[model samples]
Target: MAGGGVAGHGASAGETKLPPLTPGPYRRRLGFVALVATFGGLLFGYDTSVINGAGGFMARPDQLDLSPLGLGVAASALVYAAVIGAFTGGRISDAWGRKRTIAVLAVMFIIGVAVVSIAPSLAVVVVGRVVLGLAVGAAAVVVPVFLAELAPYEIRGSLAGRNEMMIVTGQLVAIIMNAIIGNVWGDQYPWVWRIMFALAAIPAILLLLGVSRMPESPRWLADKGRDDEALEILESMRPPGRAKPELDDIIHTREIEKQRVSEDIGKIFHNKNLVRIILVGCGIGFFQQTTGINSILYYGSDVLEEAGFGTGGALIANIAPAAISVITALIALQMMDRVSRRKTFLVGYALVAFSHVLIGTADVVLPDGGAAKPYVLLILIVFFVGSMQLFLNIATWVTLSEIFPQKIRAFGMGLAVAVLWMTNGFLTLFFPTIIAAIGISGSFFAFAALNVIAFFFFLKNVPETKGHTLEELEEHVTDGSIFHSIGRK
Candidate 1:
């Protein structure tokens, strides 16, 4: 069973009692909220991964007419734009409310997709990609927090982690669509790519429609001093016995948050503990990209083609990793609430590093002309992608959503995720070049080395977040106790 210290700061034993588990009807409502909010994640995954299959076609002379550098620019445009979007998304959500911000992003997704689908030149496509990037980046920061705030602490991990699941699901859907379209209409060239880009609009429309009727985050409402409104929302979402006490905890945290609000953004830098926490958040985001997951997702077909598969074969084989990603993400949702976040991070990095080593070794040892090389490499890549989905990706997003104090949560998450997107952008920009410069062996070995460092970073720095209410976690963050050890009680 999950275990943690009592909620609230300086509460007596009686006041520290946990609330009852939310009843069934309320649970279903929360589930629906999660489902609606995570569409942003679905759009995020699709826009980014669609390029993976469309890229080769777009580089042809008849399409965008991209040179190698232009191809890199086209591929990395959304990611770099996401850097700005993530940086601003948090602060925007803090001021505008989570639901409103997401609604706006859904609109941006539609516009961006249309622009990309109908672009007449490389410049227009980049412009469209940048617009989509902004939506993708903002969605990454806001959606997880929205889910986290709506959920009871007992189920917050699985609930917030659903965004990550949807992300991989989006990627899986993109890869499958790309395969069917590319194989059947391989002669259609740029049109096939345009069609792939356009399908993202359906989900964006669904997101806008669904979120229109959803409740504003009670925690966000409480933070804005609309306590009665917050209470009403909470009552509808929580069991009768649990609502008031949970509201009290949120009110207490907001009370603390107000004291720091006067300092504005200054507190984030002036407070030593706040700075430490922000740095930790940024580190987690940075290291997640360094694991080379996006590099594979963005360029898997290229990698497989290099390994000897034909273009069609490579597209088909790419689906295996994406399918495993969806499967492992489902398994991860079950594990999120049950396992310690720190344990998962450590195990995930270790396995990822090990997988990289095996892939590197296989590339070196396999005979150059042998039929076994591509199959062995494919299997190892599948294992690596599975390990990432089952462990790191869900835990990373969930922790980012929950780790900061209310006063700095949005800003802190934005800054951290911005670092993540920036790192991802750099990798996306250079990975094809990196693969060209160094064979698959060198690339995998380098990632393996980086994962070793990521493992130790989590061991020393990341605290266990399982079993703690956001309010309880906030107290630990503010006081600096959360950083003193990885497995704090």
Candidate 2:
């Protein structure tokens, strides 16, 4: 459970008692609201990853005449835009409130997808991707905060982590959808990409409408000293007798956050320990992308086709990894709260990094085409996706939410995710060129090297965030033991 203590100044001592928290419908209501808002995650996953399926069609040797470098940069622009969006979204969420921030992002989602759907040229498509990237970045930040604020401490990690799982699921759906449509339509209609872009608006519209009916993050309200409002919101999420303790915990959390922000960010920066927290948060994201997971996800069809599969074979093969992601995501959702975040990350990185090394070795040994060679690589990639979703991807997002202090939670998460998306953008934009130059062996080797670095980093610094409430973490943050002791107990 979340901890409690005196939070700087003094907590209010009003005569009014907090309402009781109940289970049943209250918890269900909160879960429902979280699901609705998390449509942003779905769209974020679907819209950005849709390009992966489309890439084969767009940059084919006979199609758009795109160079390897051109393919990469076009793919990368969206991620770069998302970095900017994620960074700005953090500050904007602070000022605008979580629900409102998401709404604004939904608007961006609509417009960005619209532009991409109607794009006349590759440059215009990149423009649309950039705009869509911004929305994805903002959603990545806001959705977790929304879920964390509303969920009970017992379920917070799992619920908060659900957004990421949804993101992977969305990507799987988009990839499948793209494959089905791209084959049937062929550019005779030329509107398949448009449909792909426009489909995002369906989720965006759902996000806006769902959020309109949803309450704001109670922690945000409580931080502004709106205990009554926060309690009311919490009540909507709890049973008749369960609201008060939860409210007390949330209020306790808010006060500490209020106190911490009063310190200077620059002064905090001078503290080497805090810098370590910042570095780990940023590094987690960097390593996450450098694993070349996105390269696989955003260009699965192309990668498969390059290895001697037909377009149809490539599409079918692409679905295998995506299925692995969705299945593992469902399984991981069940384990997120049960497992320690650090252990999960360690396990994930070890498997994925090793898979890359194995894939490289396979390329060297198989030399591209026995009857069994593509089949071997295909199964290996499936195992890679399984390892990624089961451990690292979910754990990385969950740990990011866990590692930062509440006061700088948004700042830390936002900056880390921005750095993540930027790294993702650069890699996505240039992967075609890189793959062309170094081939599969070289690409996997690069990923393996980075994941090796990531392994030691996590073993040394990453927190274990299995059972603690955000409030329980307050003391560690204030005392500067955030890395030393978090997630251990």
User: What TM-score does each of the candidates earn?
Assistant: 0.97, 0.92
Best by TM-score: 1
Best by lDDT: 1
Tens digit of per-residue lDDT, candidate 2, span 49-163: 8887676566655545556666676677788888988888877898788989988988889898898777767788778888888888888887887787677667777788889
Task: List lDDT for all candidates, in order.
Answer: 0.90, 0.78
Residue 124's lDDT in candidate 1: 95
Model 1: pairs clashing at backbone N, Cα or C within 3 Å: none
Candidate 1 C-alpha lDDT tens digits along 91-132? 999999999999999999999999999998889999999999
Query: Cα deviation of 242 in candidate 2 (Å)?
Result: 3.4
Q: Where does candidate 2 stray beyond 4 Å?
A: 1-22, 60-66, 187-191, 256-260, 270-272, 486-489
